[model samples]
Target: MFFKWVMLSLLLSRSLASQQEEDVGFTYNGFRGVNMSLDGIAQITESGLLLLVSTTWAQVGHAFYPQPLHFMNSSRGNALSFSTTFVFAMFSELTTVGGPGIALVISPAKEFPGALPSSFLGLFNMATIGKPSNHLIGVELDTLQNEEFNDINGNHVGIDINDLKSVEAVPASYFSDQENRRIDLNLFGGQPMQLWVEYDGIEKQLNVTLAPINVPKPTIPLLSLKIDLSRYMVDPMFVGFSSSTSALDVSQYVLGWSFRMNGQAKDLSLSQLPKLPRRGTKTKPNFLKIGFPVFGASLVLMLVFIIQFIVRRRIKYAEVLEDWELEYGPHRFKYKDLYIATKGFNEKELLGIGGFGKVYRGMLPNSKEEVAVKRVSHDSRQGMREFIAEIISIGKLQHRSIVKLLGYCRRKGELLLVYDFMPNGSLDKFLFDHLSTTIKTKLSWNHRFQIIKSVASALLYLHEEWEQVVVHRDVKSSNVMLDKELNGRLGDFGLARLYDHGGDPKSTHVVGTFGYLAPELSRTGKASPCVDVFAFGVFLLEVACGRRPIEAGASEECHVLVEWVISSWSRGEILETVDPKLEMNYEVEEMELVLKLGLLCSQYIPTARPYMRQVVRYLDREIPLPELPSLSKSISLPSEMSTCGDISMWSPYYLGSTMSTSSSVADSLLSGGR
Candidate 1:
């Protein structure tokens, strides 16, 4: 019963349209030199209209009636209707996935200002890709599957209200004798197809019918919808065909077209329409005839230019390296090789994270040697400069107590540094993992003592034993790694600076872990070997107490570990400050000596702190402990040296000032003043 009613309504609409000859508004049998606007590469040919040229990788074409149609206040009625029939063909030379397809569009403007090519069907772009625009409506013959737009398949027809996403769609086919036959049409396969679109103003209905060229029009339309165009369309609108192609290219052409408004134009005779032009005979511009050879030559030249650029860049990069960088002992690993070694930097291989970046566990392919790869964050302001500094500072320096830098890698925005994997991890984990009950090796007092002595040795080498005085700006517990045997190896030279024996180490930036920063450095923004000593002092206290340098929950006087130890010592309760986890098993006198030495090294006055050499000797029992001033009697730094002042005013001379040979040895060691 419903099918009968639908067939009756369609028949009545056609009959009424045919009878209203006097109400005709406009008509077109074909687009041959007609006054129509074209966008992209659309052109009028002797046969019909070619919407998209076949030679381009991606293209868009649009054709619209030169005069806008009147749909707002027509003589027939305020409401208006239209009917159009068109034959289209798509062809591609390449035997690959083809098409993007075409649309029968009603738009307010003759030219789509921001329409995009490819799957967008020359209608939208990233800014408005999925949004409605220009009060547009389209009946689309989509011949490509776009997952982002939820296309049904490579061949389907859709009704797009305003956006590219279809409101209603179905596979491109027509019903014949109560059986549906799929359209064997492909844009690149040169199969021509026909479509009929009709709108009824009174019923506000849109009907679309389709069939093969040789087959008769089906009794039932492939799709029908009751859509009110008055709400989406304006007074003057362009009725046209729009089509596009993407990387998978295809040519879309309209051989014949007919459109009638006000339900009055005569129906087009499909058999009488001119045939489509044969392939390869279509006229092209003289320049386009030679474009292939020109494009080929241009592509070859571009390839050569790219190769020369890469070669020149490599040579320039090599030339830019300092003489010392060329002699650096560390190997330079390829970024791809390291990326594969770390299993593409999967989370499962992540070892730890620091301020600058994360560290991952990896193994070399040839050697199968375990390594730790530090991948620095691209946004870090200091990461690149520090990477270069680390290579220059420790690339060739070898010592048992210093962690070896295996190699480095740079690719695009990524910076990676490779080092031997420390199975035991960093010291902070052992120092702070007080609540975990999981079975794992713990750092005993003896191991802690050995680590302290080893770190001291590393510092001693960096300060005086090496050819240059190296100032490690960051020396927190996390920067100290533990080997398989619990031996300490100082690592992370991202902030280290090098200076000759009598040259100044001018530093501009005041950088270091917050709790470990020397009091004098905050005010001066200057770094010296004494800064390392102050940080080591904080590390020593943390190791002995098994507590952080700064704790929020501690009593006011005990907020800082240094203050807490000093307070405890003043009250004749120094032993009480030791880690309870040690269970009184440590030697009492040695613990007291180390604790006091840490306090003496962390004094507010920079000159009061003992050198790394003296501390190492004290730890090794090679020298008797020197008399230390009581905490109250210790000299204090000037008021100006209390906190970092305005950093913008800090001079760069603090980083690389020249030094005079006549300067005192103490000044040379503490401030790089020769």
Candidate 2:
């Protein structure tokens, strides 16, 4: 039992020793409140009060008074003070928020209990200080220098607190001019690490140590502290350190006092301390609330990217459509569709060659009827303008002499024109082929005269009748398609030019075969109806003399047919110039009339040439022939002339030897009426 009592006594002493650390307590009085997480705070009432405290930071190494340290929720002016030296020592010890600066300020209470010992209650200011230069043992307040505020050099100086009463001993010379006495206060270096205070009591004495680890030992002046008791007070007053200048910067700091009465300590652990609360404010902070603006920015960026992507996609689609139109719009045809129609463009169904591309015999789909197909080459010198001109001009054109255009196709950069297939083939084969009997048996003298008149009538219509006056810039005999009935049908319009009434037939670059080009093409650089008339003149001589424009072996005589005709007509030898095969099947008067008109149309000067209308009139006996000039000079064919814009085909199976002599091959080989 005695041993148990000893152990119980030892435990009680340990508890009392810990409680002595915070023996100074405070009383709150004001319009403030404290709401704690736990039941760890007190309420002030008129009857009595209970103290509650926090112990989160209570151990000696690094203790913190986690708070709700507030005044009581009452309207009267509230004052609180630390009432014990043990509490004041909490300020002197080290802390995380910084510490070791402490003080004491006491004031007499307005009302005290009659049965209790009345004492002063007040606040305090914790600060640091040093000793005076006069070798005084404690703080000296009177020796502090007082200077007037000035702005002579525009430098900042300390503000004067003259009206404030000095209630404690001001430590002498705390603000020293000595550079070695300055404190860096930086975390990494040596700091002026000491604590001192001004006492408000009449007794003024101070003791300081450099390193306080071993309290029984004392180190000299890295710094020191002093005081003066002359101006000490018993009222609520400020008691702290002051310097002549503001150079004292420390890392850890605190401001509170230790309570003492008759030199006796009190039990004031964290659990026994009063709580302090804070007042509320009106404004909220700006940095914490940003929800809507961030969402809005994200939405705007998404919309911009979407719009840009859509615009780029649309532009790419447009470019693709444009390229398709350029390639296939003119000739719309499917390869399979065309293949079935032409029997796969078979060689046995071949018709002839055309100026722009190739011609083949074909049959339309669904209806196995025969037709002539002309397909333009992709690399043909001509482009889409030429293709459209052939399609529109040939389809809408009308004349008993004009070839019938059925339909056309444009596919994959290939242009094809379908027409009524003429089985008799081309005029060149008959005119130049020895084996062809179409020329001898079919083209009689009367037929030759009628063919010339028919050709003249077609030229007149092209130059005058249509809404658009058509100039057959290339009017060669091959361009004229003749049916089995010997009817002349003008075909091929790749080089045709359109002219309105009252518009001049402007000469263009020479564009027809040699020997058919106009004499004035070189000097004038123009192509007109007169150019066609020149080609027609050659056509007339070909029918009359039965010879090619430029025969192979004739050489000087290779130009025989034209030379003979020009020479015979000039010397009045009409019978000799006429085709020998005609016999007496044609009239001399009609032959003479056509010969004169052909000569007039082929005049060197375009102005000297007669128009097709006049040629037609002379052939039909409606107009009289003008006085003729002697053909003194021979008319030679132009070596280089422009090609006519007509396209035609000749059956290559009936190829003949070169046509240089009429006797070697029958005149029946040639029979076109362009």
Candidate 3:
């Protein structure tokens, strides 16, 4: 019955299009005669429903009015008052979380060429989001919580201008006059809902109101913002709807739509609106519907279905596109690419294992370049976007003393970070594994001193020279990776933090290796450049003395490295603490200087520690070493030593990132408004 009615209306669409624009606006009562351009999975069903997308995994859909609409006055150069209303529904069959979201977009043209799917909402891609040339405005009815966008929750509405990050956002809710309270609306509840978007040129105000399809418009808007839309608007503009299915398998539809340029939009006729079809009913072909049942009756299809379910259940995590990442070029690697590179992460290709996860050596098929991939496991699902963002953020750092962060990959829920492969492995092997047959000879004292200096230079770059102050929360011999030249390049940044140069340092959980933690760090939980200095001091003592900060000894001798070094200096035999492995073949002056400087940097008071800049100068002999604070003043040492969990394995926020960017998910948007 409905199909015949729609077919009749489809014939009258051209004539009705002109007639429908009676009150300076157009109305799509049932979209039967609607002239809308559809792309991706969007189509007008036989039952007259405007279906946006199907259950495709990672895809985007767009539907726009056929002709451009005049949003601004040509003579006045000001945005004109306009209003729009639409009835929509989103359905998710297999997942509770429905979609990345849907957006009502005002764009310069009908097509968004480089737009991305998933969290980007198909309105913009990472590179295009904040460009002024975009001339875009989107009112997003977002259904999933994206840590990268600082969304309040999974269900909310936001106003985004030229950026995927919202300018203003709030939980999805509307004020009710009858109930005399606020009513929350679920965007992905699979029910029809009405939404109104209005803009006033004079007041420079934008308001959005939402309600159940059966209810009247809400008295108070769900989200109200004061903004001059003229900045994002041009004379001839196009309006449309955009949606992208995400981790959740969701289908979206529009039942009716109405719009006006200079006056109130025409009200949609509830009785005339298209009926939303049930899943697999009118949407799927009649032959396919019956074919599945026949196969199930014969038990073969049932067995196949059972086996597929079991396979999916065993996999544990789905291979969502965000898991592998979608951006092209050097910043990200597809999971399939990485898997093939590492030959399925074979045990034979294993490099080493650390606190975070396992590391594998692989060769890129295209470049034939050897790379090291670290498989890191994370506990939070909400923070993956921000995590990948930071991975891209820090991958930009380039320095001879710092290992390059190539990119990252996600596969079967495993998070993999890729880096430039260091052939010589870590510094700890040469320093601590001298007895191993492969390491028959010990590292010369000159090389040790040079390694110390190289590490100091890298620390200086991280602390004072880079665009942001980076605090390497974990600094030890193991993390100092050695390249082909045997030069020490600081590598592991899993626990590092990026902070503004002049800003107050934020508190972090006490995290780092067991013995390298600073005295003040354990108590205050604040991470800064000073704590890094303390850890570097421990590294100095470890390298020169051929021992760790805390060793297996009596309880009182727990912090033997600092105490033994200090006692040797007091007895006028500081050289005694030098590594026996060197056989005393080292510069006495340089060795003594390193021992005393280590003591100075490891002072109990954080203020007494030399900055990385000062440490660098002292190593270079750019300045004379200052007098010691007092051998009896006590060196910084933790009463108890135990490893803190690898923070790289933690949060969506509450986790940290590089400079000028919000370290937490609560404010993870890039630096820009709207």
Candidate 4:
């Protein structure tokens, strides 16, 4: 129904609108005096009109009349064709002074029958201008040599006076073949000067003023000559300019043009001319022609200078320790000084290994600052790259429970990271081995609850408040380091991946400890916020039950601990699942809520798990309790519920119970009353 309405609206819009063509403009400048004529060919295609020409001598002409000339043909009602009207003008005043016209006949319907390979045809009228306009006629030329028009017999054919014969009639008849009227050629005699083609070959160029009386000059100057051709002949057939004189000794001055019997026009020799401006004689240089190559060389030199400047700047900035002390403290030293202070990386200075790298305890020589120098292995495959990325990704991470990263060092290959040493060590020491029973005894139920919240806040940092949302894939108890006050500090992000909002979800290789890994990793191989939720569930179960994900000698039933937590919680017997050290020290309501959150996180489906923000809210009482998880008995218990029957006895009391007397006592009381 929605698609139907959209279609209807589209139809209504189409009915109200129509398509139209918008006029576009292009530029050219060649065939002068014939207002806006172009020297190249113009053709039409599906994408509208295109004019191809060279800029040196070729120019485009604008249509004086409307293009695609439409007219009534009387028989056909309308004729569609393209045509142009032009007036040719010359640039200089050196040659003929006479009025003679030309005829231009365009035959769109005629074809030369079997004469040439492509039915080629040409016509020649006179040989005066660059290339005669006569090559487009029906006749084919035999031979052309030395600017002379030769016949089949190798004899020169002079120009016909038919164009001058019709000069007395109207100019419109110049396109007509109507005979019976003729015109005469009259010209003024004068000495012909040496004419040359002048060009700037640069920006400014000359424009044509007059055409009929001008003749192009040659490169070499020579003597001038005079001739007038009206004394020679009449009733001519040529279509070019000619001169005649009725003055004294007119027969001594004879000017005529030669024409070929089978005619063809010559192409313009425009490409041979130099494009640079002729500023001076042969010895002087032309600046315009040389400028482009010089500018190109200058640009290359400037680029090399810029690259050298940047390399030198990086060398000066390599003294990083000077700025490091300002951001951190004054005790920071460069890598060279640290080598001397640690006595050449001796084994005695080595601290235990952290996820980042092996930590080395170092003491400054003259100062009193004792620091833990984490000597990250340059060959450790995981070192400064991950460290630097984590610092950049977590720049605005403001959570109090997450560990703080001080300023770092980027030396040659080795990374000497300095961090606040946690004196009490990590949570794994107490939970896994029960080593140092003193610390284990000190870990009470209250301390355990605080640790749970602290870790949740740290996950909240990784999930929401950081500059980029970070996934701490390895979030087991081993990664939760404890500071002096036993506060949990989340660490170990070597396998971490970051996702900004609206970015693609992180696709990763299947990593992290096997038991704590999210189920979706096996299917999708992608890390979302739910991945961290899965790891947090395992951590929560570990802190509450004091159980590792996989017991050393356990069967398949004990391998996945999340399945055991849910089974024990749903039977109203979660107390049996609590850490044995607690011994009823923890609150029952809080335990139920924490167990529910873990169950929600450990859902086999990724979408069912809540975000870390939601997990933190549910723990802090900002939201209501979620639904109880459905437990399947197909999952065998690692350890049987020791107190389920005991807790079931209290459920009825909590729901309000009923009391009744025995039948025999009721019967005796009734008889006594009677």
- As a TM-score, model 2 comes out at 0.43
Better of 2 and 3 by TM-score: 3
Give per-model TM-scores.
0.47, 0.43, 0.48, 0.41
Model 4, residue 9: what's the lDDT?
94
lDDT of 1 by residue, 332-377 (tens): 6766567668897878998876645579999887788999999753
lDDT of 2 at 365: 79
- Alpha carbon lDDT of each predicted model: 0.70, 0.43, 0.74, 0.41
Best-fitting candidate, scored by TM-score: 3
| Clashes (N, CA, C under 3 Å) per candidate | 7, 44, 1, 24
Question: How much does candidate 1 score in TM-score?
Answer: 0.47
What lDDT is reached at residue 201 by model 2? 28
Tens digits of per-residue lDDT for model 3, 1-674: 99999988986884564343324578888777677898876888888888887643457889999788777765567888889999998886434465777899999887776566767777775346678988999999888776556677888989999886689998888788899999888888888999999999889899999888988998889889999999888757889899886534478888999999777898999888888876645232233243456556657656666766776554433344543456635686866667778898888998876645678999987888999988865533656676676677678787888888898766644577889999888888888787778655457888889999999999988888888887888888999988877888998786677778887778765556655677666457789887888788888988998886755432442235776676566557779889898897999989988988787666555665667887888899987876553322233322221112212111111112342222222221111111
Model 3 misplaced regions, further than 4 Å = 1-329, 553-559, 631-674
Candidate 1 lDDT trough over 10 residues, lowest sum: 665-674
lDDT of 2 by residue, 257-296 (tens): 2223212324233333333222223353332243246668
Give the candidate order by descending TM-score: 3, 1, 2, 4
